[model samples]
Target: MTKSTFHAAPLLTLCLVLWALPLGAQKKKDNLQKPMAGPRATALRVSWLYVSADLGAQKVGRVQIGREIVVAEKSSDWLRVFANTDIEEEHTSDAPIFDTNDTPPPISGWIQAKGIVIDNTPNGDQILMGAAADQEALASDPRGPVNAARTAHLLYRRLVEMFPNSPLAAEAAWRAADILWQLQKADSSSRPSAKEQAPYLRDQMDEDGLKKVIKFYPNTRQADFAAYELLDNKLCGDWQGQEKCPEKESEIYEKYAAEHPESPRTPQALYLAVYRQAVLTDMYTADNNDKKSDAAHNHARELAAKLRDKFPQSDYTARATMLVFKLDQRIPVYGIEKE
Candidate 1:
């Protein structure tokens, strides 16, 4: 779904907010071009999910420097790193906030994660700054609807740009496609002049990206959302809506049914296609006063009958049947002069 306009922040504004900091503090640049552990050093090993290491309280602001690996007696546990800080600030705090006894620092860096750093210290504010940057980036995105619909289209384009072929990328693609479909339904007018409508057509070029995500990660939560969104978007419009609607249910029904005939959702998909066609036809005939022909009304009656006969247990059967009765009542009497 699109986020509220009130919540959207411009990307530049977000960058500025994230980078703003107190002046005169020096940031250390890593001098080593590449890591070099001598032949005697053992390589550092850690798991992505759970690697335990104790960070000492003294090492708060200073950067921890160490070889990639150390020899002989190294255990499987993560190696502890320390930063020596002045005792004056440490002691001056009102409470005993410092965990002097083998406590670990909350800040951490993932091996795969990479980005520009902005902070006063190498360790403390640095990590916080990275998180802040990410948060600001997320906040700055103005992708959601600005109207009552609360529709947001997360473009897979952005996801693929930031992360390629990763799980997060897959997730982003799925969410983006889902949001795009919601935006389509909530705002029928995707024309540039329609300010209330989100600009998905202009923004997205990630159909292939989305397909890859669904193909590779069908069991993921985002994949499930993508599947539903694809279904909904595919079923939202009728043949008459071809020019206005990005997706057409009639087309989708034919394809989905042919491909997955045994699928449990096949019935629902076909029902929606017929229902949309009938609804749109009925609405057009009713609005135009049927001056030219009774084609639309006749089609609606035919579709309604088909719905009732073919899917006796469908919920749409009741609604369609009701519409048929209503149409019958109105056809002979509507807009005619009384004697």
Candidate 2:
């Protein structure tokens, strides 16, 4: 559960590749600037980019609410921007295109200035955060917009990039990373490899964004949450009736619990460890390894006791208590149940 401390080496390499532009090269090339040089902005509502400043100008593309943009110039009521419009189509939304070094080329056009929020806009961070939350809610609903989740992810990322000093920055970063992770997880879970017993057989969730959250926002609750998400990549896709799967996974969860004792996920982690131990008890008994079975039973009880002592009010603690009672009554926690 304890990963190697993240360093800037990978990021440094990426920077060299993406931002090695000669001085003034960015400005000379179609007025497109590095993201940091321009005033970061997002659409406050679904809008359109036009080929010209006039309302009758040909439509260049539709800009979804929360799509990130960088303003290079502004007219009376129009802003010239380089918008991140290379997003994957809604039908093939499995791939996320927001990585620092892997971003798609931007589209340049004029957008109406009315519905845009720039970095200097008053309370812009709060406005962006609220928009992201609304999008997230839509993403969770079956009848919501097809691209709501992606928009939410983009909005959250913009909040962190534009308002790094905002009190909401840490949570925004975590939310962005979590949304991407969940999208990737859902995509991976639908593949045939998802039926594999070993997690490595399936596609792995990208860890770069999660690692960035931990790197930039260390010691925060969001960092702890990000770390907890990383564990998903190491878990078994299916236990496959193997005691070793649960045994190793239990150790991993226990280590996370010990390292991040105050994390909101710690109680659930402890409960997972207890559940695995209970499964191990049944598996060992089936193998006629009475000694190991007895040991696992005792360990399960001990971990359950710890959960109750440390998180008495937690739902996980209550679940662990029920598990312990079933163990004491010689009930099978795995395999076919007795009638």
Candidate 3:
């Protein structure tokens, strides 16, 4: 999923070609005459990391200082190192967060060992920053939407699995789950059935990754949107393991409305609860259970009325008003009278 607009800090530049070539051409005067001649040492400040200990090796990326790293297995003037990958997640808050976290494999490269110091303290943020660099580069590729989404899903899932606590983890999970729902060729003509959904959607990951964001990280902004996806228009069949519109589906919406009344999402919850009940009436009607259908219709009418009275200014008010009339008409025809 694309992040909502926010003032994000500048993203780290790590991809080899996109970043190194331009900088390499400009810094000729300050370039080291030769590789450092000393014992292996940790990178002290922001410096270029190379694919080999030799000064001539391909430049992979630059690393932030204070990232504890191991030495090269063989002797060389350069220090061979792997990017750190232990970033901790952000703290829970009601605030909006827009950054994404990626946890792909670390980029291995060598750096000049001259000013580097001997140290081994790892920083979670550093590891996470490196991951973020790799994922962003892959995502920005000009590959067609279908192909790009497929590749992004892999990296996003890795971020979620490797750094569940990072602020970006929730966003990554959201993207991975959302992409699967869009893989079909929608621009063609007709909508496809569940089987018609991307062939690998179910294979990439289950629905748990999406739902867990609400349960495990409710305070994060991503959970609110994730909840919306889980309850999409009251259809919980796609949520958790429910095969149909289970009772729990409506409960989740109503509960979200009651608990997060101050959230901008509260109106959506209230409105969807009315919709869910209305759909249930249709389900029973299709099953030829008139009594149940009337009962459900009346219940939906009650919810729609409540929605109208509680938030008359909301756009849902117009829909809920019509819903009340529609369900009211059906309720009486099914032989249900006002109590």
* Model 3 bad stretches (over 4 Å): 1-50, 53-80, 83-107, 111-212, 231-252, 255-266, 282-290, 329-339
Reference-based lDDT, residue 5, model 2: 23
lDDT of 2 by residue, 1-339 (tens): 212222122222223334446565654556644444457788978888899998999998888777667777899999988775545422222333335454445677899999799999999999999999999999999999998898898788778867778899888889988998999999999988888888889899888888888988888899999999999999989888888899999999999999999999999999999999999999998999999999999999999999989999999999999998998999999887676
lDDT of 1: 0.37
Better of 1 and 2 by lDDT: 2
Worst lDDT 10-window in candidate 2: 1-10
Candidate 3 or 1, higher lDDT: 3
Among residues 3 or more apart in sequence or in different chains, the pairs in candidate 2 whose N, CA or C atoms overlap within 3 Å are: none
Ranking, lDDT, top scorer first: 2, 3, 1
The number of clashing residue pairs in each candidate reads 5, 0, 8
Q: CA lDDT of each candidate?
A: 0.37, 0.81, 0.52
Candidate 2, TM-score vs. the true structure?
0.85
For model 1, residues 1-339, the per-residue Cα lDDT tens digits are 221111112221222222332254344434213232211111111212112333332322322111111111123443322111111111111223434344233222222112212111244222332332343344446762242121112223222322343335554445445444445544453544343222332333224324544665655655544454455423322233232232244456546544554444545555554544444444455467464225545655665666566667877667666655655665322233233
Output the lDDT of residue 256, model 2.
94
Q: What's the lDDT for residue 187 in model 2?
A: 96
